[model samples]
Target: MFCFLRKLHKMESTWPHSLQFLLFFSLLFSMAFSKSVIEPCNSSTSCNSLLSYLLPSDMKLAEISTKFNINPIELVGSNNLDQQTSQTLILSAKTTIKIPIQCPCINGIRQSVSTLYTVQPIDTIESICTGFGNLVSPDQIKAANDLDNSSSSLESGQSLKIPLPCTCFNNTDNGVTALYLSYVVREGDSLDSIAGAYGTTVTDLVGVNKLGSPSIDPGDILAIPISACSSANMNLYNDSLLVPNGGYALTAGNCIFCSCGPRNLSLHCVPSALSASCPNLQCKGNNLFIGDVEEELMGTGCNVTTCLYRGYVNHKVLSSLSNTYRAQCTSNHSNPLSPSLPPSSIGIPSVHVLPSLAPAAAAPFAGHGFGSGPTAVQIASSATVSTRTSNSAPFILVFLLALMLVFIPFDPNVYS
Candidate 1:
């Protein structure tokens, strides 16, 4: 009887330890397979951040959960799969799957940074979000914009803000670190100027932006890599080294000079005085003429004299950098006499001109010989008349043909 009692007591003692071991491993297993929780946006309760993933082939629910470190049950519920449980079920091939992305939250509000995106023609919210790797959900976008429904259409040229997940890099403190700033390229900006202004190199800018070439168009938003020099440190005159050639710099609270040079090569500054003397000329009623000017500017200098005789007058002066002056020129007289002057004589060299104008348009006073209002206005009026005549040629031809047909006798006999 004593032996039996002893054996029973020993079993009771071991029972507690067995239970403890099981509980300990249960905690560990839960921790190992735990998934990130989707946070709510500050403004809306329905907003949930998500990421889209394209499956290469058909995969089982359990397999996907395991691969992405998500709970099988949660995955099934979130995706609305037909499966009732977290069992092995095959999902269709090429299926776009939505995975919940974790976002930083403060006081129950998500802290996500966003940038503006201009909607292009035929662009849908789903398509735009998908293009961005699904870092944001359709619902989140709708909530951010306060749209009535997700099915609402977007018009071309409309802008939308897109949110992105913030990541904390552990090695940022010790390694080469850079902060990104959003910049819009203006009419006179070049990659070299942008890099110099921000205290970074053109190579880094191109790499970060993934630009096919150094050329950038107006209204293009560039992700500028800024390592040092904030808004307070920008100085134009004394900091000539920081200003790109053909690009302007701010000095004494004003933008001064034009930094210009060869594309993708070293640049030099052109005196504002010389640039002012260069004529603004555009070919009347000819987009082709403007294209020629752009092409020539890309090469060496503007053929001011030839362009002037072609009825090209500058409408507006864009910027004078290096030896080239970019302007909107127009001429009233169409088919003007072409001059026999050599190309060299027509093209103004950078060395002959003097620098004077400050880059800032709002500068207190104009530079020496900067403003030429009456002459410019007279040229523009003449150019407008010529442009109108050229534009009406096709209409005139059509009208003349119609009149001829009305006067002619019936052509039924010819058809027979």
Candidate 2:
């Protein structure tokens, strides 16, 4: 019995030691297997924030996780990677790895306007109230605005505030001031002419005035606007040029016919406005938009004929820039009087004209001389600017990618 009990005690003690050894060895084996099982990220920068060393060919996910003091699952999630539950985890080796992130908007979202209305001219209580007869009356307008009973004679430049039909007036402050302008009616004014003068469409006038016929008569009090031409031309000149379209009027400036000092002379064919298209072509009755400028900038000092010709030539040059990309080519010589170029010869466009304006080119202003240098430079610079604008998108993307590479982190043990 003593020997058997002694043997039993020995067996029990050996069993405990065996269990301890099995547990310790199992843990060691598990760690070793883990070091060789997991794969590395495709890109070195992927999950680099959690990695302590660069990924090696032999190292695995478990080894990287231990070295970085991070969970293997966390590392995969951070890198936007898929975790493989199977024994074989093969990762793609690529120079770039795509991780979808919400891109920030470079341009703000656009919103639609709830209501849109245009400015009108010298709106009187009666005329404005007529548009919204149901909601307001002329009497009410005169009373609310403390106007005289004879509201028909409103000032030419005054803006009249009114409301649209069917729109609710939530409060007394709902009314807003709208633009009003002056328009002149000639003997042969048509609906189209009147609308063009006012910068409003026929449909808008018809809708507002509810007219039955398209015809307008002379001496009619039509609301129109003083064109930007008058303002722009005036600004360019130290003095103002307020000539009417197709009518001759004395403008306060140097004469187009004589180099004599500033005088009052009439100009024909919308003298206040500059030509928008090539000169020599008939004026299409559109006002020249000479925005607010000073008098000194107004005079090109050239005669009307030369200015018109140069205007047409300018149109031709602008059209070329609009149509073609940067390329080496020769152009035919253009007509001195028009934009039409001469026939091609010897594969090289012949050079013509002394870049300077001729003495009789136009009424030359004092101290005003034309140089071809700035004109040529402007043409080349314009072409370059257009080219850069066209290729800006691709350049932006490449720049962003370069920035990403520069900022991204890299660790040797990341993929190990």
Q: Choose the strongest candidate by TM-score.
A: 1
Off by over 4 Å in 2: 1-200, 206-220, 225-228, 231-235, 252-254, 257-331, 338-416
Question: Which ranges of candidate 1 are over 4 A from the true structure?
Answer: 1-175, 228-416
Clashes of each: 28, 33
The RMSD (Cα, Å) of candidate 1 is 32.7
| Per-candidate TM-score against the hidden true structure | 0.21, 0.17
**In angstroms, how far off is 291's CA in candidate 1?**
60
lDDT of 1: 0.37
Candidate 2 per-residue lDDT, tens place, 186-235, comes to 34556675555333455533433323454444322222211111322212
Model 1 per-residue lDDT at 380: 19
- The models' CA-based lDDT, in order, is 0.37, 0.26
Tens digits of per-residue lDDT for model 1, 1-416 = 23432443445444453453354345333322211112233433222233334444567767666544555533442343432232645655545444433334444444343356778998887677545534445555676677766255888998776654322121011122222333434457677776665555566555444455666654344544322111222222223222221222222211112222213212222212213243332344433211132223223333232221111123342222112343422342222233333222332222211121111221111111222223222211211100001222345446544543443333344446
Q: What's the TM for model 1?
A: 0.21
